[model samples]
Target: MKLTQIATATALFFTAQLAFADNPETQTQPAPAVEFLLPSVEVVASPPSTPLFSITDPKAPRQPLPASDGADYLKTVPGFAAIRSGGTNGDPVLRGMSGSRLSLVANGAPIEGACPARMDAPSSYIAPESYDKVVVVKGPETVLYGPGASAGTVLFERNTPRFTEAGVRASGSLVGGQFGRNDQNVDIAAGTPDVYARVTANKAHEGDYRDGNGNTVPSAWNKWNTDVALGVTPDADTKLELTAGTGDGNARYAGRGMDGVRFRRDSVGLHFEKQNIGKVLRDIDARVFYNEADHRMDNYTLRETPPGSMPMAADVRRRTVGGRIAATFDLSERVEWVAGADWQVNWLASRSVMGIQNLSDMPWTPSATLSNYGVFSELTWFASDVQQVIAGLRFDRAAATDDRQSISGMMSSMPNPTFDEQRTRVLPSGFVRYEQNLRALPLTWYAGIGHTERFPDYWELFSPNSGPAGSVNAFAGIQPEKTTQLDIGAHYRGGAVDAWVSAYAGYVNDFILFTYNTSMGKATSQATNVNAEIFGGEFGATWKPDGHWRVGVSSAYAWGRNADSGAPLPQIPPLVTRFTVDYTLGAWSAGALWRVVSSQHRYALNQGNVVGYDFGPSGGFGVVSLHAQYDINKRTQLTVGVDNLLNKAYSEHLNLAGNAGFGFPANTPVMEPGRTAWARLSFRM
Candidate 1:
């Protein structure tokens, strides 16, 4: 495809307004805070505006009912998919990559899930409506966050509130939807310029939803969260803050043998920032945080025990503590530099019971511990008014230790092969990018290349039953993986049109893959390494014909291969596209969303990440939804919408097979919810 022509064709894409944020006129200005109480149609299909980066407000009202977790909200974006696990807490996949490859952070702190089965994915604990902004950095284009971000990085952030006088401000929303669905959220702040306090809270609940066939799927959930922050502004450019939060929830799943009975989280953090220290030294930022996940899974709590398996329950916990310190330097008028160092430690332990046993009688046992210490530096250079360059380098010492003493098999128990073993690696990562502005065409072009060496994560090391052919176990034999990738893209804005496109290709030297085998009536999961190749991209455009009418369309696709097996990668999403149209006049507005998904024929059954495996090929499908918004005065708003408007029955390409206990045939993909309607009301004070 011709780069210039494609850029012009997608001129009206969802992120057109986002690209305007980088226009010469607004290049130096910080992005304005966005509120969800008043939403725009374009946000439903939003794309990244800058090269490899996209930013959007998390509280925005969207179709398919307001998202139950971060992963649910991300599916609306191009080049992203979610592995459905029931009604909520689906795992997110980007560019065909899942698990540790995607780094996730909240308020500058990392929070990891403790479930080996991934019932509580990192996104599960995230309440999008509680955060101010959601930022995504696709691919391994930068190393400022942490290691193992081969796919990308996602950040959920909150802005500090500064009050000029002693006063109070608050914003909140109430929502109700089909299947007994209901939700409530509120954010409030109070204090003076020198001191301030803020509180954010939310609760959501839903009952089982029926599929198009009028069959009820075992999906239901109830969740709640609350967070508090206290800050001392002291001045305009300097501030210190402390924050803490706790939340817990439970969910039922149709595709799993066990259900998540408890999903608990606890977090605390302290951060300090100082700007404009001097001429050479621009600023300093530092922070420390502690987070923990306590998870419990059982079949009896939310469902009856399967015929073959006895009643069982498992409890797991992971505690993580980390800190980061960074400083910015003004090397020259055209050059800026940032350097930082970070350290994190994670401890994991677990306990379990069988056959109606009391939970309190089970003894806790240590399982594993992992840690990482890293240092990084990044530089941004302004070559001229239309050309720029940016580069970064990072190094980390990653280590893991096994604490288990024995492993239990279907018939007996034996000494653990990797007991008391420790493994460590020194990994390095770096990236460089160049950007140029076409002064005459109102367009910008960018290209970047990056390489990263990743340490095997816990799931890769300890969860598998076996290792490569000659190795005794996964923990003792797995090796670090390496990835090298290149990305390129362009953006264009013309009168009534806006567009953007990004493409990437990469080679993985040691990709960690899993293989499942059944022998002697027992199932075993083996972890192995292989060389692989991957490539994909996303493009879109938007057109605004008049002051009251707008139209837009966008699409994304991804492909990957296992170099060693000569087979298609498992669980890769199929080509997908979305079309949108909206009209607005005075205090009333309306919009329609149309989504099209292609059939996925490729399959690598029993080979995938921990969350899911390929069930089989799926047929293509389409769904349409419509929504309307009303401004009930400046401080209040009302919005209503219906998803699956035509009541079309469908399932996502990336899905989990239904469990027999749910009355679903073995190896069959679970179906999505049927037609649903919802309404939301908002208030600001």
Candidate 2:
């Protein structure tokens, strides 16, 4: 800590930050800099030396959005699907796998909410416009992110910035749409030779939407978020950055039993990047993050209740703290190695009361804590110009501990006196892949095999009433789920357009299933050690048929079956297809899109549908949309689009049913959002 030593460390640190700047400039400032640490590098992006897709490419037309939760964004890519939960926050599924199978990482941090009902899911906290990149890896392709993700891993990242010359940059947008909806967004940044700062904010609001049937459904929502970032960039490949943000919003659900009264989030994180770390290590990254969510739900909001009826209410909050440090080593031109360790801890609690008077008598339970730690390593080697190899391994330890105990309410009637011990387990996962390039055929072929063993998450444990048979609930009973799978795909790109197709098959030991009964208002779900199999694939094709016209088509399908029970898995998306055609001239481009989905008549027996339980096998429907965009210049663009152009009446297979107290009758069904029109204007400065 001497002045000379401090000076040396500061020089090395600032030099790293300099790398992230788009411009090479250094300024002298006295503001104190904060540092953060992150777990490890996810090696699944591109096995060896290949490049992955970038979210910022201006020429790449954005993928259209569907009536969905954020999971639709994930499904746009190959090897992705979701278990629909009405309209938003759909449970993301990977290669026919769901629940805790997929990993969600925000700003290099891992988080899981505490509600057994999953009302406060981790993805609910993410905003599409807030991040710079979204990467999805199918199947246990990588192990550096978390312990169990038997399905895959998703990474949401905001880029680190650097400064060259003294200047300021800004971008803003305003969007107005039909169905009582509108939005405004702004992104501004300023920097000098040595420092850079960025701020982004956005607000969106919408009222109740009607389905294709023209029937109004209670689907109103309003949300806003702001982010501030600061960085010091000294070189082209290094950066020291800090970020903080706070967001709050409310979303009304027509399919759920309760509406999200409050969705508040606070996040803080720090990141550091270093290139040329040593003789062998090429890059070093460190980051630390803290994120929290406070969510509330009630029956009276967004719906009509019976006269003199007591309201049903619930409130829950969760917080996660995590950090990691990782290094990438380049042993030689043909071989690369990555090593790192990560740890995350989450704490959450909830309070609920059912009475004619909001709150009559009920004690709020103490907080529940779940902790986890893991270390992982991965290596990549280029065997030849036509071949490459990748291998990875990871080990994890996780546990849930209760500080307070009581037989609250409904559980008091049952004899529950054996729950004082801690729950813990060790899990290991690994994967290997082989890729070959066929130059003559203009094709790339890749095949990979992976295995994952994930410990039971909080939702799979304490939320259920039965476990592997001996214990009273999954909390003390269920064992880790083990999964092994093979992934193979091919990509062809030798013409005006490019195309890729990927597929996967897997076997899961101890698949987790949830069973619900409406009469008793009880759900019996458990992680049974039964065998299961799943498979699916997606294909994308884009063609520049003519100079002024372009055609694009994408399709996906998935299937899953419980080998032991001989039944289809619940909540799986059915066969779906999409087509689009666009024509452009001078400064304007017009496009029309069509989507068709087949009915999901095949599902598990007595399984829960998108609603609470087995309530629907919605009829198939078709939707069409039209979009037109005008480009004024390189820095400004305007886009206008009309969704559900036909205004057809239809409900999604995964829709939540209508509430009896709400305007909807007990026999009525939930409705989808009605036809809407939207216009967007963007300006860059």
- lDDT assessment of candidate 2: 0.68
Best candidate, TM-score: 1
lDDT digits (tens) for residues 521-611 of candidate 1: 3346888999999999999888899988889888899999999889988889999999889899877899998899999987787788777
Please name the candidate that would achieve the greatest lDDT relative to the true structure.
1
Candidate 1: deviation at residue 481, Å? Answer: 1.4
lDDT of 1 at 101: 93
What TM-score would each prediction reach against the true structure?
0.93, 0.87
Could you give candidate 2's per-residue lDDT for residues 126-151 as a string of tens digits? 66555656766767888778789887
Model 2 error, position 214 (Å): 1.4
Candidate 1: Cα lDDT at 608: 82
Which pairs of residues clash in candidate 1, taking residues 3 or more apart in a chain or in different chains? 10-499, 11-498, 11-499, 12-498, 12-541, 12-542, 13-541, 13-542
